[model samples]
Target: MDQAPPRVQLITSDVRQRAVLAGALLEAGFGVLSGPSLEQADLVVVDGALPPSELAAACAQAHAASLPVLMLATSTEAAREGIAAGADEYAIIPCSRQELELRARLALRHARARAPIVAGDLRIDPARHEATLAGRPLALTPTEFRLLSCLASNAGHVVGWQALLREAWQVEGSQGGRQMVKTSIYRLRRKVQRAAPAAVRILTIRGAGYLLAAGSAPPRPPTCR
Candidate 1:
């Protein structure tokens, strides 16, 4: 199935600004939506002219839904508040439309990277936080689930340890998370082994990182002697 472009919800009281921003986003290959529907929205772009409480509430809602938020802050103070309200990024007014588009593109890149990823026998649904192996559910913790999802997203491709930390645990520039990844991968392997021992395998790459062996049942990380 062909996937649709990531949709952005433009929230602004200024009709003219909203229209202009929406048009720019569409030109940049995004599906534009007006009004706030976090569940339906892949990302949110709101105006700073909006009441502070409302901005906070909207950002909060979008974030809780795992939707990324971008705000149009009119001033430095507003930008700070917007961040506090949960916006991942905000632009001061008079900001170029090109910059706005780029910001949205970057946010969507990270967000979409984590969307549902499927391999042969293993199916991973990030939205539902569930993974199934050949019709059987694999027990996974939230962390374990994310780890598996990251590996599955790059199935058959070697994933570096740092990449796994950033993608799965959201940890960056820290070696501490390495141990967490190791332990989590170990547990995840056990779950997969129990759920569909004949199907999936999480491959450890020694000095490198890990990967999810591709294809269907009998998938296992190859041993290099």
Candidate 2:
């Protein structure tokens, strides 16, 4: 049997822009739903021009639902703002219809690729965007969850910096991308330490990339006589 077309929730206050985006997505074989409702939606496309508060709220709601977000921004700066606000990926406004379709498809593809990862005591559930080590939950942001997922998916292997950027941010050759990876990795390390020290380790492979290795469980304390 044929599968149903993916449903997309398009969020933009501008009627004209929403109409245009809806047209492009429909032409690309996607079902479009307007408004803030995320029900039955496979993906979300947001307008960066929305008030910062609105944009952030939209992205947060989508992520909370385990849905992927694609933001349409007016410029690179706006795109960065969208990403910082929790968008999974972005496209500059006034882009070609082809590019828009491609980006929407890419976002859906990435979202579908998320499968649970189990490396030793570390468990990552991409569907729920949750991670835990040694039965303790690790508080992680959306970006951090993506970064950890990428590393754990390739556990024990050196995953290059560019690979992390592409997997986590869905962008390649971005300026300051390396630094962004570094900063997020630092945060992930701290969280891991706090949750279950030595149960998992994200190691830097000097000029190579990062590696996610599951460490031996911590030693148990001696019992009182």
The lowest-lDDT stretch of 10 consecutive residues in candidate 1 is 216-225
lDDT of 1 by residue, 77-151 (tens): 988988887777777877676888888877667567546678878898775777899989888888887788878
Off by over 4 Å in 1: 1-3, 113-150, 156-200, 203-225
Residues 1-225, model 2: lDDT tens digits? 999999999998899988998998898899998556798899999999999999999999998898999999999999999999999889998998899988888887888777568988999987677899999998888899999998888777788889899988999858899999999999988998888877888888777788888885332222110
Model 1 alpha-carbon miss at residue 185, Å: 8.7
**Could you tell me the lDDT of residue 101 within candidate 2?**
86
Estimate TM-scores for all models: 0.59, 0.55
Clashing pairs in model 1, backbone N/Cα/C closer than 3 A: none
Pick the TM-score winner.
1
Q: How many residue pairs clash in each candidate at the backbone level?
A: 0, 0
lDDT of 2: 0.86
